[model samples]
Target chain A: MNQAGYSEETMTNVRAEKVREVARLATRTGRARSGEFLAEGPQSVREAMALHLHNAGHGGQPVVRALYATEECLDRYPEFEEMAAKASGVRTRLVSAEVLSAMADTVTPQGIVATCLIPETSLEAVAGLNPRLVAVLCRVQDPGNAGTILRAAAAAGADAVVFTSGSVDIYNPKAVRSTVGSIFHLPVITNADFGHTITTLKAQGCTVLAADGYGAADLDVLQDDSAARRNENQDKAMLEEPRLESPTVWLFGNEGQGLEEAEMARADHRVAVPLYGKVESLNVGTAATVCLYASARAQRRNCT
Target chain B: MNQAGYSEETMTNVRAEKVREVARLATRTGRARSGEFLAEGPQSVREAMALHLHNAGHGGQPVVRALYATEECLDRYPEFEEMAAKASGVRTRLVSAEVLSAMADTVTPQGIVATCLIPETSLEAVAGLNPRLVAVLCRVQDPGNAGTILRAAAAAGADAVVFTSGSVDIYNPKAVRSTVGSIFHLPVITNADFGHTITTLKAQGCTVLAADGYGAADLDVLQDDSAARRNENQDKAMLEEPRLESPTVWLFGNEGQGLEEAEMARADHRVAVPLYGKVESLNVGTAATVCLYASARAQRRNCT
Candidate 1:
């Protein structure tokens, strides 16, 4: 093989104990016991490597514990090769297609997978940073929804994302895949007490906004009012009011039952994304994205 | 039985011909042959029923062809009773849990499923309505992404949603499920020629905007400029410019590969949803929702 650092050796045994252990990371109990998660597909593996490189000098531990890739995947995707070269600390192992399949949770693993230490962030650390925008997912069970929300938060420039204890495990392969590499972009705090997280954010001068379908404050009206205020003045104090544009933490709830009354009450305001048509409401993922972007746009305007 | 009009029948055999026929609608070929689709779970069934009732007098066909529910499901959900009462035209049948399971595509079928006629809308019909906002899904393959886009468009007050022929089947069960009952909210046109759709939309005085990651136009800047223009004047002509606030159709492409070059050329503007953080870009669903809502907000302000 002409490729440098590409292992010529191949693991052909699909039933090997090592391959089974890697596949077990797909389950919550397996992940808890191993303290590692699988980052499958080229996008996820690439991003994980990039984050490892970026955090190298910040006292962050090596995230990419090992990489398993097929020879064809390495040849077809040059980016994977580049990522492997960048993360020299990660152990690379060439595997057969069957071996890769045995280690992947998905029907098709895209020829690349990585074993990574589960990333952790503390709520107090997130709150201490005084983040201008944060996303809180409370009891959100769908891994896809949870991952997409994290992705949305990152794109919307949220400083952090905190998932309550009742939420899905962030390291779940399905959730990690849905993030589409955004999981490596910012701080994601998991398994935090919902009430304490909200209180901490509030103490950090953040206005906690609960997203609910039956909430009193309409999102459109809130945006309109904020736009009006922005048009009136560019003063820093005026722009920093505890409204949609201010330092905000958006609380999103579960797929089936949304935020309970107690959860909604923990927030400073309950905001509803208005439905102009007959559609009853937005899904948690779409609603969270809109709310995050609204704050992103407002905060950017305030800065200008 | 105390329940009025409730059938005291149960279908215990999962391999019954009726069960097999209902399960077939989960596939494209099955839906094509039967001219019907499955609306699974309570949310989808309820919305399908409401839309059926709403369109009853408008020369629309009977939408609900048949209803399959387990006895336990009917006993637990009173809304099912209400829907049954409202939809007297629908053939209601009681089935065993196993029979219902055999007929559902989801892992958990939520106890109720309805076979509904495929709702059809012509592009000409959509164009003739002079819709202020429409969402065009061009070759978007992900069923969940396609359905979420439909849901977002309806929530954003779009008059219609058009899916190009290359896109996933609108009747795909996952897409229908992801719509969360929003599928029946408005006119959804599928299998339309992409170029013809754009030209027709343009001829209707609608501005065609293609969402691209590499586009020159920034969404936030566009929103800010439109907001400024709206603050300056409320004149009808001023509001009708080819801007974010004007009559607009947002073109979103596939999950992996966005809009092609030729497709981008068809739009009046190619807008990029700004990424404030290190995240490479937004998913098609989140990006489309933000774009649709931006236009929704701008147009609503213009009207005021």
Candidate 2:
């Protein structure tokens, strides 16, 4: 063994079972069985590893099961080397480029991938915690869109994210890869029953707003009202029932069908991000980001 | 075609020259040689056809060269049938599902595809139009992110979108598909020289702001300052030179590298969308939506 302690013998066999097992995480059923999902690329791997360390330090279980990287990738990201030295129970392995590619879902995995143990977080657990803001996806089919919304929610400091039944798997490889490691950052409730979720959130005094294209309440006006309430002691609470500054849940619907009338009716208010130009409608992910950030800004501005 | 004037013997040949030609549009070189790009699915085709008719009314060229659709697609969208009748120079044909799939980039092109003339709009032309808002993508290589920014820019009522040299092709099939018909909503300046584009925008009195993660100016603070000035008469213009209400240009860079030091220096103000959570950073597309919407609200609020 070299004194440098960086490179172990690089695994070159492309058809090895270990490589195949890692590659299988790309599928829903595969991940479900293993209780693990993949986080791809340097940025995502870094986040996952960091979270693992943070969790480990708090006497919590380290979620990362294993780490895979090419020799070139290890040299490029030395921070990973430092983490690997300190990481407990993380099996760090150097793999050939072909093996690394075989183990990842993306065409370009950027030479690193990590498999993380999926934590079974429940809606009941989240509701009990008094989450200020939550992002809910109902039947959002696209993995990329789902991941984008999740990432935005995390960026906006959303307390929890909920995915109703029929929604894409949050652990789907494309979704996990797309998230860039946000899956490790917050509580995610998957395969949730929408009715129970709404009821629980309501019981907790949370205002649920549907992000609809044709919603009656404009998001801008609501934000202005929230800001006015913050800037000046306006008590416009009676005029605007579901204020953006209040503890809230944003319900986003499917890409093609959008929010069904029943789903729209369920929310306390149907809030729309206004279209200022000729663009007919907002992309679901785009609308989700705008809505999440709106609440984030409103809630933060009021607190400070 | 039958007496009903539909279903012209359903084109079944997947290898026909016409099919191959349409398929070639997916490649940049092929599109460049043909001077055309493809608009797939119902939404994009509908927008393209609408623009064609609008242009034809003004003695301008009809952008749509031809449309190929399946019988089922036609049955689904009768509006396409009506548009075909109204369109002057557009050729329409019906093809089998296999043929349609072979011709387009996406597997599910929703049974329809249209080839349209690519417009050559210059930065100089856009600059002369007294545009209040512009979204500039500098070397953004991801087609999806580029399209998201374009779509959001259109939604925010940004007058034009600019793609500086070294950026991904705005007309790439994936980019066009991701734009979701916003491609036809506004002017797009492609292959623009960064220096000239900046100079032109500045000459037109556009306050150039770079959307950066490490910028000095916080977006929320600027927004609040703008809103306070709007609600009350607190003009803190001296402190914040590039007000949100001003005719402005936002410069965004590559997803991973972000704005170059030189590029960031050129901007009059470096603005950041504050991240309020454990998530370290924002996705390029998500950040674009937030920034664009911020300007949209500010510009609209001030006017009305």
The best candidate in terms of TM-score? 2
Which docking class does model 2 fall in?
high
- Candidate 1: clashing pairs of residues: none
Name the weakest run of 10 consecutive residues (lDDT summed) in model 2 chain A. Answer: A1-10
lDDT of 1 by residue, B1-304 (tens): 4454456567789999989999999899999999999999988998888777777757686788888988788878877778777777888888888999999999889899999999766989988998999999999999988998999899999999999989999789999999999888888888989999998999999989999988888988787777777777655344433588779989999888899889999988888999998898789999998999999988887766
In terms of lDDT, which candidate is strongest?
Answer: 2
Q: What does candidate 2's lDDT look like per residue over B120-206, in tens digits?
A: 678888988999999999999999989988999999999999999999999999999999999999999998988889999999999
lDDT of candidate 2 over A1-304, digit per residue (tens): 2313344678899999999999999888889889998999998999989989988899776788999988889889888888888885788889999999999999999989999999867898999899999999999999999998999999999999999999999899889877878888899999999999999999999999999988889999998888888888744344666789889999999999998888888899999999999988988999999999999999998866
CAPRI grade of model 1: medium
- Candidate 1 per-residue lDDT over residues A1-304, each given as its tens digit: 5455566568899999999999999999999998899999988888898878777857686788899999899888878778777677877888999999999998889999999988766888887787999999999999989999999999999999998998999889999999988888888888989878888888898898999999888887777667767788756335433478889999999988999889998888888998877888789998998899989988887656
Q: Pick the candidate with the highest DockQ.
A: 2
Mark the regions of model 1 whose C-alpha exceeds 4 Å error after superposition: A1-8, A82-86, A236-241, B1-8, B82-88, B236-241
Task: Report clash pairs, candidate 2.
Answer: none
Q: Write down the C-alpha DockQ for each prediction.
A: 0.80, 0.85
What does the lDDT read for residue A223 in candidate 1? Answer: 73
lDDT of 2 at A260: 82
* Model 1 chain B poorest ten-residue lDDT run: B233-242
